[model samples]
Target: MSDTHRWVEIERVEPGVFRARNARGGELHVAGDGGELFTPVELLMVAIAACSAADVDVITSRRAEPEELRARVDAHKVRDETGNSLRDIQVTFTARFAEGEAGDAARAALPRAVQTSHDRSCTVSRTVEAGTPVQVLLA
Candidate 1:
């Protein structure tokens, strides 16, 4: 196992807005419009979507010219007696390749990318599944 302690710092800018800054100096801005309760889960879902799309890009680039790609990630959380959390995530990926290509091969690649992301690529999903500490910061 790699003992590198990967760190992600998130700072709360408002009630439902947060800025996620990484150890490598990368940053992301996230927010929600409703109550303060829903924003965090949405952020996780966005992470899944983004990571899945990235995986898809990697898969497609190896075979053909990728013109466009998009992903939609949906999650369901089941609450227990103590109002704790149990989550189920599903990601739907849609991609469009450049014309005059083998459409079947391009179409087939989407599932492989989704599997790779869910099984290997997405860090947030892995961390959450492993019950790691997810730190929340208030600015």
Candidate 2:
């Protein structure tokens, strides 16, 4: 299988602010601190949650439209010998289905959908869990 190459160009917008643009022209602002823009750490959590949500949504929505489905990703910012990093990362899901046969079917599939996403489908969560190393290069 061929995987799409993912890359983004982060251009400095101002002091402590940057804009990340993907090849398709999507852009989002980022910051380290002191701004409305999402911090890098927060973006990481979003990635984990969004990736799982995508996988789970596709699976469960096929059964029935979701009444409500959301994931909350959180972690503790810690400074240790390992330097600044996150710990105790958690991804919590809140899903609700309406009272109906279709809803019941969706409900039945919810647990499996979430598990499959976490265990095998969500690349973001898997990468984080695997402790993938980053190779930084100077341009």
Candidate achieving the largest TM-score: 2
TM-score of 1: 0.69
Clashing pairs in 2: none
* Model 2 clash tally, residue pairs: 0
Query: At residue 110, what lDDT does model 1 achieve?
Result: 72
Clashes of 1: 0
Clashing pairs in 1: none
The residue-by-residue lDDT of candidate 2 on 10-49, one tens digit each, is 9998889999999999999999894777998999999999
| Candidate 1: regions farther than 4 A off | 12-17, 30-38, 77-80, 84-86, 102-104, 130-139
lDDT per model vs. reference: 0.73, 0.92
- Each candidate's clash count: 0, 0
